[model samples]
Target: MQLASFSGFIKTLFYIIAFYYIFRFLAKLFLPLIVKKVVEKAGENMYQQQQRQQQSSWQKNQNDDTVIYNTDNVKKPRETKKVGDYVDYEEID
Candidate 1:
């Protein structure tokens, strides 16, 4: 019974080591691909954000260009005579 338990422990340890190595090997193989995909996605997102900003700015500029402020059509207020007591004071510094 002791021998059987010892064998089982050894088998478990071997499997653990084997699984660990397998995980490490697979990670090494696929880590770069995953990183590359993440980087590409980030780049695409940044590019899309820049495009949106540029499009918004361009639209704002186009809207600004279309605005027409005609001062000729605006009526000026009639000038009125000043009616008040004028007081002259000297400022002393």
Candidate 2:
């Protein structure tokens, strides 16, 4: 009876160790696949979000009526005459 119990205990311990190693091996094999799928999904979601934002901005610009003209090459108005008069004065002591 003691020998039977000892064998059973040893069997259970062996099973536990086998299961732990199997789980670790499977995790090493599948973890990278899972992480790669998740990263691809996140990238697709970000790309879709960016596309939506660009589309919305384009639509908003189309719906607006304001016409913005570029003024980089436009010259400012030049003054015709000087307004302030020059006054000559000497310091008195």
Candidate 3:
């Protein structure tokens, strides 16, 4: 009877080890797929947000004429032309 119990205990231990290995293999197989799905979902959400922002900006521009800066009325300040702002330096070895 003691021998039978020992054999049964060994069998149960083997089964537990097998189960652990099986679960580890399954985790390895599915982890990448889970990460890939999460990344894809995040990318899709980012793209959607960008598209919404662009659409909203476009709509706002269409509703308002002064949404963009007017280059015609805003003249650039005149500056005096200067020659040779940078000095050429020579490195001696």
Best by lDDT: 2
Residue-level lDDT of model 1, residues 12-57, one tens digit each, is 9999999999999999999999999999999999999999999998
- Per-candidate TM-scores read 0.64, 0.62, 0.56
Instruction: Please give the clash total of every predicted structure, in order.
Output: 0, 0, 0
RMSD of each: 14.6, 14.5, 8.1
lDDT per residue (tens digit) for residues 1-93 in model 2 = 345588898999999999999999999999999999999999999999999999998898899998867898899997798889999999999
- Which clashing pairs does model 3 show? none
The TM-score measured for candidate 3 stands at 0.56
Worst 10 residues of 3 by lDDT: 1-10
Q: How many clashing residue pairs, candidate 3?
A: 0
After TM-score superposition, what is the CA distance of residue 5 in candidate 1 from its true location, in Å?
A: 0.9
Whole-model alpha-carbon lDDT for candidate 3:
0.92
Clashes of 2: 0
By TM-score, the better pick of 1 and 2 is: 1
